[model samples]
Target: MKVCFVGSSGGHLMHLYMLKRFWADKERFWVTFDKEDARSLLGEEKMYSCYFPSNRNIKNLIKNTFVAAKVLKNEKPDVIISSGAAVAVPFFYIGKLLGAKLIYIEVFDRIDKSTLTGKLVYPITDKFIVQWEEQKTVYPKAINLGSIF
Candidate 1:
């Protein structure tokens, strides 16, 4: 299956990368910041640079929505997965419209509180995985898969 891994750089990107066991055998591409860490980590991989400084930035959010529409439409992945810091929003929303299954893994650091990105995508995600059981209280339908670390 074709997979789209989307997230911001650093920890969010690392979280998705940790799932190599799942995406390793699948045809995959990435959507993330053009930062040094992401550039080094994803070198030689098919990747699309996304708008960044994405935290509560309405401008980049709108820009990324357009980016999401174009990239997701052309790549057309069967599934889109993320452990997010904000960049996942546009991709998940647009991917859902394009009939891709959406998966969101709540970040491992937030145990009791739900992330803004997790809350926003939960209603639409096909699979919502939590790294902590306490997170399930915040995301009642989320499956506690323990930490991805």
Candidate 2:
């Protein structure tokens, strides 16, 4: 199955990387920020860089939406997974619209409260995974996969 992994840099990307073993043998690519850390960690893996300043930038969000739509159309991945900040929003919606299974992993840092991105995409995600049990209260349908760390 072809998988598209999407997430921001830093903790979000790190947590998502922990799942590398699961997708190691599968056909996969990534959608993330273009940063030194992401570059070093991803190595030679296939990746597409999204626009920066995504969290609250309406202009870039709109730009990234189109980018996400195009990528979804071209890649046609069977599944799209993300541990997000804000960049994943467009992909989540577009991926689901394109019939790709959507999986959203709640970031590890937010145990007591739901993340903005999590709340926004929760309804559309096919699978919502949480690292901590407390997060289950926020995302009742979420599967507790323990910490991705």
Alpha-carbon TM-score of each model against the true structure: 0.98, 0.97
lDDT of each: 0.93, 0.93
After best superposition, candidate 1 residue 57: deviation in angstroms? 0.1
Candidate 1 lDDT tens digits, 1-149:
99999999999999988888988888999999999999999888899999989989999999999999999989999999999978899999999999999999999888888889998999999999998888889999999888888
Question: Candidate 2 — which residues are off by over 4 angstroms?
Answer: none
Q: What's the CA error at residue 12 for candidate 2, in Å? A: 0.8
Ten contiguous residues minimizing lDDT sum, candidate 1: 16-25
Off by over 4 Å in 1: none
Q: What is the alpha-carbon lDDT for the whole of candidate 2?
A: 0.93
Q: Which residue pairs of candidate 1 clash?
A: none
Model 2 misses residue 95 by how many Å? 0.4
